[model samples]
Target chain A: MNSTAVTGHEAATHESEPGFYGTSWQKLMMWWFIIGDAILFGSFLAAYGFSRISAVNWPDRTQMFSLNFITVMTFTLITSSATMATAVAASRRGDRKAAFNFTMATAVGGLAFLGMQAYEWYHLIHNGARMDTNPWGAPAFGAYFFAITGFHGSHVASGVLILLITAWNAKRGKSGPEGVELTGLYWHFVDLVWVFVFGCFYLI
Target chain B: MSDTHAAHVEASYRSYWIAWAILLVLTLVMISISTKAFLIGGILLKSVIIGAWFMHLKHERAILIWSVVAGILFAGFLFLVIHFDAGTSLL
Candidate 1:
């Protein structure tokens, strides 16, 4: 019933070390990783922005992408992030059943998003999109699109795998609440990156 | 569980759903509008909501929050500087 004893990892950290900013070392390390990942995406987007501005005939996004379909993909990721948050909360409250269920739900959502992304890629490639060339206006368009979205998709794929493992561990009472929270952080970071990608690449 | 603790849990759950609703609304609005400025603003707002609410940054200490915010802003600044150079090179 100790409020500070929400997770085994956290309790252990509190007893031994004050911890940087009073957060578990594991959580702090995760944040650092997220920051580094953010920089990676930021650099990619920056390069994309340069290509967009420098290009004489940038491809028309409206013609290349189906806005409605992209919106659905966005919805899936956001909903999955919400479910991840719920899982973390449930785990913290000692409701392992709910936590496991929500974690599984989040993994399902991630799978759905990846499936949609694959379809989108297939649709584009079928229409002559490739790394070197495309039916689009700029040759760099194909390269940037593939690089950015492909990297993001890879992150989602890995996140789904991690979620499945987390759920399995939770069901077996092997992982603690901190594990759920850490995974949730990573999941939300993926969604966060998509917000930028959707806005910078698709909307704008 | 005590009544107060139960109520707290309920409120926390409700907040997550509320964040989700706001995110959906923002996405719809972003797509409906074609203005670049509005889209950028919407993306930034959505990022803040996701970080603060869903990621529980609001519950973290000031030092951690500032570290994250500062790190991202510095990266963005670096991007802008590099972009300016790229622009000049083309000119």
Candidate 2:
């Protein structure tokens, strides 16, 4: 931890200290924001649950979706989460190379998950279950589907971008603790959201 | 500050890998169970475990964890109350 703002110690400092958003604090705030946003997504999912109950002919999830592919995707994602955590741990230990490799591995995992999701979306769309089709009775189903998962996908894409930037900075020896930790926070949040999504949309 | 201290820091990271392994197994278990039955309660439990251990939420301030819990509970309560009305069915 750096020292608090003081008189004599401040004079010799050549570099400006980064603000909270500049590194760890910014990442902490992002986590807080994601938590709140997650609640909103949860509400949407809860509403979907409510709608599922209300529908007279609620489609069978097992019939409509396949668990095998998602199973592979799930494994890929969870493994990615592991790699990302390893990256964070390595960064904290100043093993920059390990951190970079793990971060890249995590990004590849994210890409794989997204690719699987894209395939799932294609499968769903091909079956005449367009976002507006409302294969179930509730029209809100499609709305929530696109809105929540789309929002999450956007976050995943952004996380990938950050992972790239972090790796770049690491190679340059310019990456700082806050930056690495903040990226870790974002990666964890993405995985957390998927846990709930898998439960709500695919499983339950 | 010293080489020995840095080594200690590195050693602490070992538990992180263990935590990650536990989470991977839990995720597989949850997906399997999700197919057999709609276990909302179980999902909640698994989430708590992962969040606390893998996500390091356990090391976070009590207030932060409580805030998240309260938010989820409030949302749950509101949904329940709204759906309790007669002729209302939450599918």
Best by lDDT: 1
After superposing candidate 1, which stretches have Cα over 4 Å from the reference? A1-17, B1-8, B86-91
- Backbone clashes in model 2: 6
All DockQ scores: 0.64, 0.41
Worst 10 residues of 2 chain B by lDDT: B82-91
Report residue B2 deviation for candidate 2 (angstroms): 11
Which candidate number has the best DockQ?
A: 1
DockQ of 1: 0.64
- Estimate, for each residue in B1-91, the C-alpha lDDT of model 1 and write its tens digit: 3457666666779899999999999999999998877887899999999999988898789999998898778767766776765554522
lDDT of 2 by residue, A23-50 (tens): 2344446566767777776787667667
lDDT of 1 by residue, A1-204 (tens): 211222233533343343768677667777888998998898888889888877888999998999999999999999999999999889877899999999999999999999999999999999999998988799999999999999999999999988988888777776687878888889999999999999988999
* TM-score of every model versus the real structure: 0.91, 0.81
Model 2 spans with C-alpha error above 4 angstroms = A1-24, A134-139, B1-12, B34-38, B85-91
Would you list the clashing residue pairs of candidate 2? A20-A26, A50-B91, A52-B91, A53-B90, A53-B91, A54-B91
TM-score of 2: 0.81
